[model samples]
Target: MWKWETEEHAKAVVVIIHSAFEHHRWYAWLIEKLRVEGYHVVMGDLPGHGEEGKYSRIHDETVNEYIKYIKNLMESALSYELPVYMIGHGLGGTLAVHYLKKNKVACAGVILSSPWFALQKHGSLIKSALANLGSLTSNMKLTLDINKKALTNNLQGYQEMDDNLVYKTNVTVSWYKEIQLIMKNLFVPSTSQLAIPILLMTAKQDKITDVEQARKWLLLQSSTEFQFKEWPLSYHNLFHDLEREQVFMYVRDFINNTTRGLGYIID
Candidate 1:
């Protein structure tokens, strides 16, 4: 885990959870932005990802492992004695949901960026059958064909991500199965409402996850305060896209609003 303390008097701690196949390093831009805004940043790689994935690829990862990882980060963030907020991207967003459901942490709010509750594309029947069969073996690997261009429109950001060696594009059968199970339970009626304030953002042109599903999920939420915004021209990675400055502004506004609502004064 890594923590970036704000040079100014910190207003709150923001725990960032990155998307699948990516690592904490990819969030340098966001981390610095939050720090500059007087918010401490804490983030790290999930199990079987980033540095760990470099040595051993994703295999046999369980849902409990992901939840536990985020729980530890949340605990660390809470140690600052400031309001703790969570920003999760893609699969990380889904993991955040699972973590919140299982653990009763003192979180100020949450922001989900294009959460992976459902995929944009479903596999063919044959491929689905193979994946189900492979789940029985649990160790079978599948190389994901992710389109870097579809993630962000900024040429420089796209180039940097494409050249990054830490990103993993492979997933094991068990890992896929685990994620599928989590997605299935994400919107169950019994646990649909999250008491904390929520900000759900989606890219209209996102090709990685289903935007409609994300919208549907947001509508189902019964949070005390919830907001949904769809970026018309952005792709999957809203923070890395061309309109990142605007996206950051929205995040800042959300934090500001939530903090104020909680009777916390922000300097």
Candidate 2:
């Protein structure tokens, strides 16, 4: 349980989920933006990445288990009876897509900033072979970091993060194994039943995840209400980039347009 940013008289509640190796407070600026736009925002520390955790423990769980944590989080917030909207980055985006595919959580829509359809900056043939092979073998941690530099644009800001307070569980063997499976679910070829609209923002310069792969993933989506934007100057952490205010505005306006029944899907 993290916190509710507004006094509770918000027009809607925006729930934010952060990427791996980061904590909930990482979305502080985005939360502020939503507050200014007259929305209540709630953010919680994911199981392993924040101050408090659970009986099951984050590192010990498989990727599907981790996804269940996200759904449980959404269910708890939906109980508050505010129309919910979800914004997730990287690993968080993957979780959001899973929620859309499997559950009918009543959300206004979803915003996915650089969703991890495929990990970034790797030899395509080699990476695919390894990813597939790892799925069959006992080795769980065979995956490699695609772009290590994309971890943070603000090195000082990253260093200032509390060292004792872990931000994420290290990417595990089973986690990598599970990601291949989750990716399969994301691009499921048929049964167009996605219940909510989606907005996907990718960075042309993002080194951690392939922006082209993200575009392909969006293409495979069965939902017609899908939008994609490629920010030429942005990196993996677009929400925290120098032009972050613009990113925030993009999200706010998208929410408003969707709420007003404007079919503003883009690419």
Candidate that scores best on lDDT: 1
The TM-scores, one per candidate, come to 0.93, 0.81
- Per-residue CA lDDT of model 1 for 169-238, tens digit only, reads 6776667777877888887887536779999999988988988888888777778698899999899999
TM-score of 1: 0.93
Query: Ten residues in a row with the worst lDDT in model 2?
Result: 52-61
Q: What C-alpha lDDT values do all the predictions have?
A: 0.84, 0.68
Candidate 2, superposed: residue stretches over 4 Å from native: 52-60, 121-132, 135-148, 154-169, 262-267
The whole-model C-alpha lDDT of candidate 1 against the native structure comes to 0.84
RMSD of each candidate? 2.0, 4.6
